[model samples]
Target: MAHKAEDRTYDVIVVGGGPSGFVAAIAAAREGARTLLVERYGFLGGMPTSAALGPISPFYFDDEQVIQGIPHEFVQRMVADGGSTGHIRCTNPHGSGSYLCFYDREAYKWAALSMILEAGVTPLFHSFVSGVRVEGDRVTGVSVTNKSGTSFYSASVVVDATGDGDVATLAGAEYVVGREADGAVQPSTMMFDMAGVDTAAVKAYMDDNLDDFEWASEMVAVHPYSERLPRQHFVGQGFKRLVKEGMDAGELHLGRDSVLFLTTCHPGVLHFNSTRIQNVDGTSAESLTAGEIEGRRQVMSLSRYLIARFPGFENAQLIATGVQIGIRESRHILGEYTLTADDVMSGRKQEDVVARGYFPVDIHNVDGVEGYGEGGVWAGLDDSYDIPYRCLVPARLDGLVIAGRAISASHEAHGSFRTQGGVMAIGQASGTAAALAALGGVAPRRLDVAELQAALLRQKASLRRDPERAREERRRAVQAVSAALAEGRISAKYLADAGTFTGQAPRL
Candidate 1:
């Protein structure tokens, strides 16, 4: 049963109101394109708001700030609401200077909404993108269903940011699902919020049990059942192994255990973005439904555990659950170039690099993989890499650009580049490229790289091509550290500390 089509048209249409769609709508409209953003939810902020993820992680690139433009502005506004810190060297047991901030999720949502409205972008909420309208090899419009019924909204260009590549898939774009070799997709998380907690007591527990409570490992074993799950472990040999190296180097803080990514938010209130729901497929409605059901069960159990285990949480209550299941990986539309694990490891910079992602390849397991157990697979490069423009341009699509978790990249690369900060960078690029394509009457895949760079520059993006300045800073840091070692003023501990401090070696 279909209703009458509205046939309302705009210059651009962005589907999904997550990080990518929010930025895409703003970017296109700011460039003078009449844009419409449709979201199934009433409010925006995607995962951060919907999931109640109070903290935003990995906001810096190396020792310097990387993500700028709209995303930075959004974060800065939130930081202003609280007391936001800036540009510190992140290196410790769990990488202290990674520049993650504990924020107000509601405030973030309001800020994102304000930015979109100010850009003069029309946002239609409670409307889901049901079908895409295409003519021949190009996408011309999309059909969205709401309380009114199924209505078509035409557009000159479309950017897919549904995280699962929903719009592009519906629009006839071909894509790949999961991994190729081992059939591994990144694990999904179900975050929750707790109120009536004591910040001091929880922080003390974290310090005392830093090694025994391993949330990632324990959750992988006991989830999909239990309303009273076991407590998360933080104090153990595994955590010790991670901290000993960094603490010894002097490059890291002595109490490096304080920041080992345990599921400990502020004391009185806590956000549980820990439970790893594995083997869930984002594309299938059935699979996603199963994940959601299992996720809620695990969350309830975990919440009960928090009440019983810690001192401050005796009165703690589960106040909120994620509005939507947090998906880590999904259907990726095959693009002009496939980003490989090698590109990320080597920190390769491409001439057509559109956005930069510095987060590590934080892969969770699928099926019966080892995970970060006693001797787990924990390998990552201590640098950021550039995502080329070709990765966002679908191989066969003319009017579509892919952003967020579904951008064309290997499963390994996707794990690293799928954070909120990284997604914003991709969204900015996609929106800018779409606007450029519409103006030039050219395919998004064929836009000139130099011209795009100029536009990005005018927008104050951080992709300056001064290879010499970057090289010189590394050289100076190395030279200074070498001198201290030669003078015997520093021990083997000192040399190791210097390497880690300069970001040459792993934090721990």
Candidate 2:
């Protein structure tokens, strides 16, 4: 029942309909490119919709909104639709000085589709990019398989926003996967939602027993628990004692030690991001299948445990789970420039900067166990770091640019920029660059950075930092670090290891 269709051509083609791909397609089309967006799923919004993830994070660094343009516009639309609470201050102790945008998954799907369509981007849904047409060092087009049968789509420029570098890999681009030392990727999660929860009871219980929560003491030091918990949107992570008791009695099989929950705009519905599936390779179907199965099992166990023991959850019901397990890390295509851990930690700026990452290095443990030898690593940043255009341009490859989590970065750096806000900004940059390159008849690497930056700025994208503010922030951070050292809040070894912030070359 398969029929061959005539090959379609476009000025730009973006594969993947996630955060990055969605924005990329819209940006390309708005820039006057005949753009096409291909998605494996029938709908868009990527992880937030398909993976049931909520509360998009790192929209702000300190007091500044570092990520803007198309991503911000999408949020505003979602807000106007009553699908989101807009951007709210993050109260989580681990992610201080950040903001999160909470929205309904169903709303995200419709909003994304409407925006892409309004921008004149052609969207091909339920189509998988099975292969790419490469001539010499450039990718000419992609071969996709859908219900209509196999078809070839030619484009002047291609954007790989697959979140796994699928197009780049198919086109023979060099890439790396997982941590460099051990080759182990971050653990995956299966996010789920529950309804019929008594939020009042839960909040009261947390307020009374703040000592039972992880980082509760630190959070309370700044913002009181009562003031921090919003009725419509709340995020809490803690339940160590309960989880331990469940594990001891063989009632829980999940690896996580704490329960992470986020409240939705709905009265009593809450999202749970507590399920952890370990050692799952996202690129392999077999591995993903196993991970998904395990994740569902964990979700069931977690929901049952919460209902039986947790306050206000006695009558809670598991409403829905993610369609698939959420992969935190995957293949990073090697580009002209690889964003390094130093670049992210030092808040390095570059002349060719296209995007800024404000999220901290949040590496979820590769192994499933929590609070063991290496449960996880969360290193906060005092300011934002720049991501150069070269990170999107694959080395030795033409006609293609990478976006989302798969953009070229060291393992540690990827942890920061992989968040939704960071990737959306990156998508805007990559899409604009792709359109400019295709229109100008040049490779993405050969496109003028000035032209790209100007186009992005005109589109309301946030790229440059305020020089005086940046200097003041740096000075404040230095002072804080020194004060911490003197007060014994940090060790001398930690300061030595943090390296100098004086703009000098790092010592061997």
Candidate closest to the true structure, highest lDDT: 2
Report the Cα RMSD per candidate.
9.7, 7.4
Which regions of candidate 2 deviate over 4 angstroms? Answer: 1-7, 92-97, 216-232, 371-374, 466-508
lDDT of 2 by residue, 450-475 (tens): 99999999898989776676566445
lDDT of each: 0.67, 0.82
Q: Estimated TM-score per prediction?
A: 0.80, 0.88
Q: Any idea what lDDT model 1 has?
A: 0.67
Error of 1 at 434 (Å): 0.6
Q: How many residue pairs clash in each candidate?
A: 20, 0
Model 1 / residue 212 / CA error / Å: 2.1
Candidate 2's TM-score reads 0.88
For residue 335, model 1's alpha carbon misses the true position, in angstroms, by 0.5
